[model samples]
Target: MEYVTLGKTGLKISRMGFGGIPIQRIDADGTKKLMKMLVEKGLNYIDTARGYTVSESFIGEGIEGMRDRFVLATKSMSRTKEAMAKDIDISLENLRTDYIDLYQVHNPNMEQLLTVIGEGGALEALKEAKEAGKIGHIGITVHSLEVFEKALEMDWVETIMFPYNIVERQGEELIHKCSEKNIGFIDMKPLAGGAIEDGRLALRFVCANPDVTVVIPGMYDVSEIEKNMEAVEDVSELTAEELEAMEKVRKQLGTNFCRRCNYCQPCTVGINISGCFLFQGYLDRYGLEDWAKDRYGAMAVKAGACVECGACETRCPYNLPIRQMLKKCAEEFGA
Candidate 1:
């Protein structure tokens, strides 16, 4: 229940904000229930994105009458002024609020970032929206270290969202820079996309970082919310046992594992890149051979279907050799 002012924006939000991606798996009513519980527990920050497939709408429906109780934030992938302007309106309507506390430019690579800040770019629309009182602050979400570094220098950026977990500490230095620059540093993928089995350990590792203004772990149910809240609210220093557990997690996950951000999608051949990696990890690392095989079998497009177009690798923030990895998966699964 600890609260902090989001850098630059001065938005006072709970250290543990609600990530809205998982709500896509549930209905609007389910989201509404979670929203009610969030209010009761005093967890008031909610992060969603227009690309998260119904996430914004569900949140809008969930927070219907209780809009003022939350600091709402969302992002869009639109790189153009027209598209961003349109997305801002859509987000406002979907979130059931005319004024969004924060609107962000979704993950854009170096080229797209330049285009977005250039003439007729999304930044124009975001600034216009701020002037129009549609949004309170502007920010950017990035995956690669290059973009993270570049975003740090942008005067328009009030906040930055990046993946920071026990295994994904590559942004540690830049995250510190965020605090130095007075730009809110929002931590995403605090659980390393569910790679770290211990939720409490994952949360503790993130909450311990003073540079992180907020950590949004996607929640869909009451038990998860309560459990995550307990982990976040415990401000005590990390116990020796917890530190040992975190190291163990880093060792097991290594640096090559997937975080399942789903930035690599629409596989030229329609392969579920992240899903394939998920099942493969379970098959290879967790000894869930049968379960993994079953899930891999169910996929409409298997890893063997990858034609090596390399389109996905270009989008991957980690620059994962997805095609080669898929080849390994295909060999292991015998697809």
Candidate 2:
């Protein structure tokens, strides 16, 4: 695997970092085996978040005796100082680590950003914890390109995690800004949450960007991991023809790409909004129809949960009519 210094943090990370979300679905033993395999293959940067249920715990359990062998990065969404301290402690216990290599604010919305970084907030708490050696670096993960550029202007942010894929190039300008500022750019949703079926092509597209320091793709199976490793090994510069082909695919996919931006969230009826959009895309883009159907069937609220509330639409960065989309989803996939 190719290694690059993660900008100002000075930590060298594998170009293909292991995103820890998918592992939450696997059994403990399965996760352990996959973790071992990934480590053996030279993938040392593992990224997880408290929001990804059981993901941090699984990584901790999987890497029991090999804790020092890799760099561990995890995030918390807590905005208050007290909650931030508690979440950090909880994360440390879950990850079986005394200190984290990188700790991030997990996709804070604009309001939360102001509150957290404002006087006597979570950002101050994080800074204090860093001084205490709890985390090696302070980073932020955001979904909006605007927030990303704003983050680049901050002195405290050393790394950024955001969505960047072949289809959604909205983050392109922000990626260039990060590179120019010497901030590490971590590409999340590099495959557009499996909306792009040809994993090799999607992975290659992101890696082709020289500004990207690491690309984290969530893999659930060993075959997926092996394929990703192979793709990284044989990584080639994107040819003009290939770029045009991908652009064609992007046009065909259109607004079908789920950046997992979480812009349309907190449904009035309490639906896990992003999950619904993601599983639907799985059926449409990756042909995982049965899997998508099963997952949709399992939602407690399902798509019908959207109460025609205008809240999500107002909040959506893409201006997606979330209520109407949810209605469509319910008609097509709700149990």
Candidate 3:
């Protein structure tokens, strides 16, 4: 595996880091297996979050004895000083470590970001933790371009995590600024929340960018790690065929496809908004009809159950046409 220094933090990490989200789908034992593979392969950067159910715990168990082998990073949604401090302790306990390599304020909007930096805010806790040696550095994860641009200007931000893939290039300019300013830029959702079917192509597309410090595509299995590792290590420009494939991907998904941020929650009818769109994508784009139908069937509240109250759209950061999209899903699945 190839490695690079995470900007400003001076921690050398693999070009392809481990994203802890998918560990929720696998057991601790499975995570241990992945940890073993990662250690053997020399991928040292691990990212987890307090919000992801059981992810931190599974990773804790996975890296039990070999904790020093990886640079552990995690984030929380807490906005206040008290909550952020408390969450740091909880994350430390969950990760079974006394110190965390990086602690990030996860995905705060512009308003929430202010609350984080205000008096009695999460930034206070982050700074205190760094001074106390509880965390090595501070960073942030963001979904909005506004927050990304703002984070670039903050001296406290050591790293920034944002979505970058074949379909989402909105942060391309800010990503360059991250490099210019010496803030490590971590790429999330390299597959655009699994919307892009060709994982090899997706991984290649993200790794080709010189500015991306590390790209974390959530991997649950060993074969995926090997494939992604190869894609990142190749260090070659996009072949003409790959360029054409990317163009087709851009045309197919367009700009409006859900990135699966799940900001649009509490679907008045309890519909799993992103889940419906995911299954719909499988059914429509991937030709996995029976498989997609089975997953869609498992959803307790189908897209047809949408009340069209326009509540979800208001919360969507991307401002997706979720109501209309759900209507199409309803028609597609006969829900």
- lDDT of every predicted structure (CA atoms): 0.94, 0.85, 0.94
- Candidate 1 lDDT by residue in tens digits, 62-120: 89889999999999999999999999999999888999999999999999999999999
lDDT score, candidate 2, position 162: 91
Per residue, candidate 2 scores C-alpha lDDT tens digits across 193-254 of 77677888888888888999999999889999899878767676788987887987787689
| Candidate 3 error regions (>4 Å) | none
Residue range with the least summed lDDT across 10 consecutive positions in model 1: 257-266
lDDT (10s digit) by residue, model 3, range 49-160: 9999899999999899999999999999999999999999999999999999999999999999999999999999999999999999999999899999999999999999
Candidates 2 and 3, the one with greater lDDT: 3
Ranking by lDDT: 3, 1, 2
C-alpha root-mean-square deviation, candidate 1: 1.2
Can you give the TM-score per candidate against the true fold?
0.97, 0.88, 0.97
Residue 257 of model 2, lDDT score: 45
For candidate 2, the lDDT comes to 0.85
